[model samples]
Target chain A: MRKIGKQEIEDMAVGAALLGTGGGGDPYIGKLMALQAIEEYGEVTLLEVDEVPDDALVVPSSMMGAPTVMLEKAPSGEEAISAFKQLEEYLGKKIFGTFPIEAGGVNSMLPFALAARLGLPVIDVDGMGRAFPELQMVTFYLDGISATPAIIADEKGNTALLSTIDNVWTERIARAATIQMGGSVMNAMYSMNGKNLKDSGITNILKLEEEIGKSIRLAKENNVNPIEKVLKTVGGFELFKGKVSDINRKTETGFARGVATFEGLYENKGETLQLRFQNEHLIAQTENRLLCVTPDLIAVLDAETGLPITTEGIRYGARCVVIGIPCHPKWRTEKGIATVGPKYFGYEVDYVPVEDLAKKGVTL
Target chain B: MRKIGKQEIEDMAVGAALLGTGGGGDPYIGKLMALQAIEEYGEVTLLEVDEVPDDALVVPSSMMGAPTVMLEKAPSGEEAISAFKQLEEYLGKKIFGTFPIEAGGVNSMLPFALAARLGLPVIDVDGMGRAFPELQMVTFYLDGISATPAIIADEKGNTALLSTIDNVWTERIARAATIQMGGSVMNAMYSMNGKNLKDSGITNILKLEEEIGKSIRLAKENNVNPIEKVLKTVGGFELFKGKVSDINRKTETGFARGVATFEGLYENKGETLQLRFQNEHLIAQTENRLLCVTPDLIAVLDAETGLPITTEGIRYGARCVVIGIPCHPKWRTEKGIATVGPKYFGYEVDYVPVEDLAKKGVTL
Candidate 1:
């Protein structure tokens, strides 16, 4: 377990932004918040899941709202603490640790702030191990953990506790509350004991995220293709390189959702790629076939700057590269396909591994 | 409570169709499923909450999916039963009765099938008295019952048992599974013991639904305005009477989410109303002020036919009447608004009582 310095966080901010693949929201604000917390409480220990005691009670917490809104309505430091403190009081147990929800912009950094404030280690793992739009779209769901008794705290010091019958309702009701509270609020949810956490969480995901982030930073500094470094670090497959020609977007149910139509810029020039997104890319469709599907990580990065572009940030005429990384092996099984594949996103395409798609383009 | 027969079932179906507010899909299918189950088994007894044994283990079950899909792909009756049976096994206890998750549309009738097949009585109550998009967006969620141990059964006889840490995860993961299986799947979730049921269930909601359904039927047959009858039955307030001039819809995050813009047709001509919806109506806004906000049920119905228009069914040139019913008084409290109100849905407007809105000429 490494004790990261303030300098590492700066590097992480850059790398996290690349891994965001255009939609984790700006990491700058969350980075600042986390840095301040670390300064106030000292360095946070990043614990691997194995290092966690079998009997320890760890809760995964973060902010749940519009990232676009997060940019406009910055979170007060109090909210993160309030959300965590409320859960601690409700459980009548000390929180042993915390962890990032994903390896993205703000979400990746938000947990570190909580851990620093609470003087607890941040777990090196997340449920999805990647970003998803809704609170319920996590491996934890597949593993049988509930997101209820979620604590949501707004900037005004008003705190709300939600214990739903299911995670979807937690998102639904909490979403409404977030909107009511001005589109963004800090939430600490997915409370569970260590036994369930060990059973459900993706082990060492933080280390993986940090590595993914670090590789991109190193690649950028070396003037090499960050995409290649990402692929090497995560075993991701380079799907296509293109220039974004047309971008269409709309906010649906508070999700910044839309599509980006890209014209191939490299050897694949004149070939168009269409990527659909709802917070995160779900599908990458070419004229001939579907290249990447859900559950697998689909990201689009600026060809020149290597900056990740979010759905809301997509605009006309941005050169980009599309990459696909294989999800956890468990997500490839029948259960995984049923939960987060192309068909799950309303596409009629079958699940195609990123490696296969890289070697042989998907058609039909 | 009145014992529902085949004849009453038909009337209830029609009433539910009108109450569905252009969503909830077609009630005919749920009616058919329930009728078939009752026929294969026997008549289902509807017992008031008070009549249920204190020790009776009542499970509130509903099928969570897109209503449009439910109409296309009829459910195999086995899923609910399988879920109930599985939950029974997990609990190591026999379930005494069943109840509907909601008392409107297909959800309202599904419990009958489970009760008849299980030889258990159906309770005269539900979580939401009307329809909602996600399973977890229920009153039960506010009351603190988990939707876990949820059994999701597909038409292919593939049953996935999910035990999530929260309800949101339950909905998210299950929804992914349902979409992968096809567009829709059957779910028997929020299985609660009678003690929990008594504590969490909305007492007498089934009876209220029946009464609401029957009143609409009687009003229609008597050539009276069914909307008025509905309002009188539930003390609802008229929010707006308008013609749907534009319906903008697109699918996002696996949900048919969009906005329907209405132009007032009668006394309020020249005024415009926009109702934003994901699965259920989340916000109602006019040019001047917020007409109605969530947590207060906002339903749209055909002005002439008195039939409800679903969010998906809303189209250009449709004459519609928007109604705002007071959600259960429990929802009007501070906690309730925090859980289900306009603020809950991300509206800047403060929650105005439905009755107050009616008196304020749609500007409240």
Candidate 2:
């Protein structure tokens, strides 16, 4: 295990934001809070899933709700600790370690803060390699893990422990409760051991996140194009190069969903790239071709900084570069596609892997 | 203390339905479930609040969500037991007894069923004298009690334990979960002791429910005015004797809310009464004067059968009688009126007790 210091939080947040795919909630506040917690609690240990014992209980903890609401109802730090302890007491087992449910924004950072507070390690993995709107959207759930005996808590010291028939019910019920708990809550759910974590979790997303963050930081220092650096580090490709022209966003079914349209720039002028999202960017298309979709990363980055520009942050007249990363292999399977595919999101298109979509004029 | 047998179930259902106002969900399935449990478990003991040990843990248990959905998800009779047992496990104490959270429909009967299943006594009292749409509207809340450390469970062996910032948060969050739990969930909450129960509960509503049911049954058998018998039994007054004119209902924010209008019959021929409700009847008025409002009782019964009709059960051209019963004394206080009064229900009128409304030609 290695210790995560202050500098790692920014790197974690940056990578988490990129993986956020335009929704995982803003990481700015979480980054700051994580830094504060680290400063107070010394530092958090990062433990490999392989290092954990099979009998050790590992729980993933994070904030769940609308990103917009989460911004307003900033947690009191103690919310997570309280929830974790209470959950432990209810489970009658001490949590051995913690992990983030998804590789995105605030959630990717919350477990670190919780681990620091509890003197435990943050597992070096996550349920989803990228963010999705619902609890059932997680890879762990797709891998047949139950997201139950969950707890939803607010800073007001109010906590709710939930056990549902399935992960879908967990998401539905948790979302409603979050709306009432001032629209945001801290949750500790999906208790699994090392064996299940290794089998169900997306392996080494923390290393991937750090490496991705490091590439951007290095490129920025050397005044190089972050787009190329980001592409090289994550085995990704450029989907579009453009300036955000028209953006529209709205909240639907307890989720922030909308579309961001971009007018091409440089070599791609006169072409339009349209990005549709529900919490995380799910689809990218042009007037003629469907470029990428859910379970395939659709990340919009600041043209100069390579910083992730979230769905809520998309504004008119902002330059951006869209990148696509191949989703975890598990998400590309028949069940994965069926669970996170375009059709699952109400689209008629079939699942076409990003690696196979190279016939178009975009950079690979 | 008394043992509640199958004979008392019908009377309880009848009176509970009356107290349901326009909603509390249909109690038929709940009655049947209770009867079956009683037949198997023998009978449930009804314990007085005073009989409970001062330190005994007492949790009020019931179904939560739109009453309509509950009609479909007819519980497997294990939901309440699961929730109660889960709550008991969470509290880490033996539940000395159980009580109904509200004096309406399913909630009124669920405790007895739960008690029978668990071999525990059902307290002959409730948190609310009459049903209200929201959890915060309970007399326990009005009397400065908290409805936290609660548990919600569905028939699929799923249970959610909730401890919110307040009863209002608990209701809002729990309702959202119930909607997701297929629209009806059994919950065990408000784990207070005998002292708190005596201080906050609306006492003797179970006996009252029995008396009202018996009076209507006897009156109907003797071919007398069942409406008068109902009033005489509950210390209530005739609000209106009419034929159903129009009933328009719709669900809003998780509560079954609607307006039921009646055209007067008998001696009050030409007058009309419009009842507006959200879960329970909250307002009663003609074109001008307000007849009776919330915290007070507003019961609509079939003219011939004297059977209580729920909001979901209200239909066009149904002949009915509306009776107004004086609220529990605690509900008549300033705090009571403020918490569940006409103004609280969005009416622009001052609350006048049902007895006082007699001077205004409405009820006495």
Q: Residue A186 CA error for candidate 1 (Å)?
A: 2.7
- Each prediction's TM-score versus the true structure: 0.53, 0.92
lDDT assessment of candidate 1: 0.74
True-vs-predicted CA distance for residue A293, candidate 1, Å:
1.3
lDDT of 1 by residue, B1-364 (tens): 4466676667667656544544556677888878888778877787878787788767776777676787777777777777778678757788887877876677777777777777788887778666666777677787778887677766655555555556766766567556655667667678776777777777776555666778777887899888888888778877788988888888877666788999987776888999987667877878986777766678888888766677767778989899887677666777667766666556677777766776774545
Binned by DockQ into CAPRI classes (incorrect, acceptable, medium, high), candidate 2 is: medium
Give me the overall lDDT of model 2. Answer: 0.83
The ten-residue window of minimal lDDT in model 2 chain B covers B355-364
Q: Interface RMSD (C-alpha) of each candidate?
A: 12.9, 1.5
Best by TM-score: 2
Model 1, residue B163: what's the lDDT? 53
Estimate the TM-score for candidate 1: 0.53
